[model samples]
Target: MTAKKELLGSLLFAWGANSYGQLGLGHKEDVLLPVRVTQGLASIGNIKCLVGGGGHSAIITDDRTIWTCGSNAFGQLGLPQHLGESTLPLPIKTLNGKAVEIAAGLRHALAVTAEKGLVFQWGVGMKSLANRGLQTLPVPAFMSAREPCEVPGFGHVKVKHVSAGAYHSACITDQGWLFVWGSNKYGQLLSSDDFLPLPFFIQPHHFEGEKITLVRSGWTHIVARTERGQVYTWGRADYGQLGRKIKSTQDSMCKSNVIQSRFTPEKVPELTGASQITCGSEHSLAAVGDSILSWGWNEHGMCGDGTEVNISEPRQISFFRNYIPAAIGTGAGHSMVLCRSAGQSGGDFKACPEEQAVCQGNPETATT
Candidate 1:
């Protein structure tokens, strides 16, 4: 399949498995071809931003509107009640007004808002690493069917951006602080082992010094890019997701559970100048200026090089050197990118007016 995509006049491209019309290509068949997703709803000109998970998709319009399709097993689509699955991008109710950015995980959703000035989550609910329990999540602060508040000390925190791991969550707020919660089994929660709190907000020592620029959460590890162009990682190092090989040196100065398990945030050996970031099921991808870097699992070419060999440490993905990447998105096992262009708009092709607008171009960075 020719998966090369160019940003031109607001166009949307669909490739890979499409069993649920999640590809929005009119049918429920896998798409080995680069088909345009211009359909009944998207034609009105929305051309909003688009993100894809394992088998689901999310689209946000320029007007702060949100739409979702595909699997809803855990209410990841933010629909009123569980709808099972969707064949195409469907408008989500009450999701408008002041949305700045949106992110998706294997079965969860996250968003940053203006008025609320915070991060919100909903979906499969992240499981607890200590208690080993599962709960539904709504984002900025953990939620239930009744209340949604702040993350303890992070009260009324205005989020700058948000990201999600397979079962965890991360965020950077306007206060120049990074807060992580949900699922810390492998220390993906970036906290001490014994200090298990119910979706409590804790700051990582590695995030000190300068303010952060961007943050990306992966399945088991999390990476962040700062204004200084330095990339930092924490959480789950069993697979070398921290971008360096470590001999598993976890020290628990605090917390009683430290005796049983050691969970501590450590810095990646030698990585710098990251311009963009994204994460897959168990691997990671980033751009240092124009250099593409991949780390962690590469079983299915998820590393984006040309090999299936896993990269426990960092490796250069020297595929798109000449092009400067603008944006990035990752699915359960694949990745997508957007390149900056001159007067080019990723064309919109949906059937309805509400779905019409300027759509974010899906980078053909391919599953590699």
Candidate 2:
């Protein structure tokens, strides 16, 4: 019998603000164009996970090893405090086990191990009475070690997937239950402004029977998708990042009046059938069919909709209506998109649609 050989050919590229060299381009130079990242990680096997945060980047390879770069002021890179910052990807040590999944936020990082269903975290976003006097950890720490640790108000549960936000964290349990912790000032934790020192289960029968499949957090907002293809959002909506319009009834006397912000999870309209979702610091993107829909803050043209205005409702970007996006990543002030020709396989990559005539030839790559 002949053995089957696996082939993996994935490329990683990045752009936007490189003030911290988070793009891993070997320099802290910002580029308006996407450049292929090919340093330090050229020898790594297939990339299993690639995520970008405010000023740092992280990736997990098929070999189950974790690599990180950029700002480490709060040890978001999982390296020791004395190591300082890095412009190139470096392996993280002292992890209990091989990392299967990883997530990064503005000032914190989280990783899930393959064996024992363990989760580890580091950085300063997390707050608690025990560490009240301290600021932030310059090294990684255990959130749940060998055995499961019961959350203060919520019962004990094993986490299957997790996401770290700017000042909060979220996780989905093996039972499809969702829990959150950390700063809830903007109600990003789906409750009061009181900071939750421990994980708390979000109550609401709306997600009772649904199997939570995916959850992503922005700087101060969250986007969750279920097994049934339903999307829900909560937290800051000052820039319409929640994909809903604002309705104010109070008088203009309150100039600093708050707009619409969901203290609880609310379903976002027009994103019912999305398959994948990613969030920037204040913007979000979702993939449905062959098109990409984006909304929220776009002051830097991060929405990629050919406009600098903020989007309050989900709208498909006509440029990508024909080309299907394979993956998407976002950072504090930029967006990255990877695409492949829809309905075409192998080497059938072609030029973009005629409407976007500016791109007349088969481009070297597809990214924003």
Candidate 3:
């Protein structure tokens, strides 16, 4: 009679702009409400994903280990060296546990390794402030790894998923192909080469054949999702974040009509079936079916629609309607929703100003 291994924890909750503490909730302020986050993440057993970057926050758990927290400056929390900031949650241990999938950006961070998926990357690489016309400022064209290296040529290329925006990085090859590398500025790596540096596949007739299972990144924009559920999108359409709409093209070298910025990929017919998708820094989210759909840069509401205004297309949030989402996250402004109560089994996290504030718990007592 020896059977009792049901751990599987949950219940993490966090809120908008945690300054540099990145909401691990130990300090650095800015949370605005929903807090929990349990210090350095209790014992770290269940959380399989929760990434929020720009200030930093990783966590990958399920024992595959990763757990970072708040700005390591340019090292992007791969840890080691001088240790700039960490509002708690440490554990990088050289990714020995195997880290399944991870992504974070605006400083940089990426991972993916469960044996052959092998990806890993580290901070600071940007450069291409929109072809240097943003009027200056945007340096560090390379600093790739301060710690967890291994992003060579993909060895044999197994990578399942990986994304990091603001600066750039992407992966997705289990067969679905997709690749991509750093900073194409607003084109988000559809590549006119503002700064590609390495990994660059992205061509299966521009996804018209349908394969990519999922992909996400924003700060510049990109939202993939195809296996039939459709959804495409491409980089920085000003503030509308490419949720569809931005199509003025007559500039055969400036004959005149040029609104540009999407650069390539389009689709997003309203996010087709969207099972789940995320991005923030400019805003984007999708869950569909039970409903969750949002669009670009809602000022500070992060597209919750209570109106800070930006949203160009999608829109359906109405507070999750009744709750069923399961998981979805985004940062750089804030948005997180791990739901449950449709019939109830216990799980509800929510964030992003759905009014007064709610962060209830009980993921089986929030294990430790």
Candidate 4:
């Protein structure tokens, strides 16, 4: 009997801000169009996870190894600080064949190991002034670590997923419990305290009897999805990062006058049956049913509205109406979707319809 050949590697396409070569395209030029990343990931095996930070990116393969590229400033790429940066995907020997999930923040990164489920963190630590106006009262810095260090706690529980915001981090255990740490300047941790240097449980009561299955963080906000497909968000809302409207009296002078931030999690009424959720620096995206919805900061058209206006409410991205998103991701100023053609099958890749619309009749620029 002949053995079946194992399929190696998967196609990855990236676009948007590449000022630091975060797209792994072997160059530092911005990609206005989705381009396949083939420079350094040709033999890594099927990709398990992909994430991007402010100016860096990371990928996890089926072998459970990590490959990183782009800015390594502050050592966010899991490489030696001296290496500085790389435009090609380089294996992170420290986490070889151990990591199951990974997440990237603006200046830091986190990973969950497969064996003990221990969480590892690297890059710059979070810090914020207690009172910006009073330099003497400034909060102490959290101390940066260039190499991976096991995040204290979670020794007994097995973490299944991890997430990182610009300065905060979070993880969900196999038991469906959520723990968060780092900056709470905007109450992202659901605490009155300013900063949490160590991980702390979010309390089961806050979830209202429903276990959280997944969580994602923006620069200053968090969004979580329950086992029942219900979505909740909290933290900063001045930019409408929170999907729900802040409670306020009808007689309020104006929208700006009302307190927009939510210290605790609240249901996102506009989203239902969310299968996947991701957060950018100050924006969010979700795959619901067959469509994708986006909200929050849209200064760079990341919301897919083709406008630079900030989106205050969850709106369907018309550009993807004809496609069924299999997975969705967001960056500080960009968004990406991986989907198959509507009628095509058997692992065939389908280029974004918008890409086709823009490149049509231009043979040299066709994505497929």
* TM-scores, all models, native as reference: 0.71, 0.77, 0.34, 0.82
RMSD of 3: 18.1
Task: For candidate 2, report its TM-score.
Answer: 0.77
Please give the range of 10 consecutive residues that has the lowest summed lDDT in model 2.
354-363
* Residue-wise C-alpha lDDT for candidate 3, range 10-94, written one tens digit per residue: 3445666767777676788765434446656544555656677888877676566788888887788888664788877787887
Clashes of 1: 36
Off by over 4 Å in 2: 1-7, 33-35, 38-43, 127-156, 204-209, 247-261, 306-308, 317-323, 343-368
User: Per-residue lDDT for 304-362 in model 4, tens only?
Assistant: 77677788888898766766654566667666665544454323222332222111101
C-alpha positional error of residue 40 in candidate 2 after TM-score superposition, expressed in Å? 5.3
lDDT of 1 by residue, 1-368 (tens): 11112223433444445555555445667643234456722453343355666666666665666777777766777785645677767766655345656777766777766576566666654533323443242233343311112334445666666777776767776655667666666766656553233445555446566665566777767777555555667666555566764443266445444322224444554557554566776777665545667788665565667676778877776655544454444566555444433233432121221221112111121000
Return the top candidate by TM-score.
4
Kindly report which residue pairs in candidate 3 clash with one another. Answer: none
What is candidate 4's local distance difference test score? Answer: 0.69
Candidate 4 segments exceeding 4 Å error: 1-11, 32-43, 127-143, 251-257, 347-368
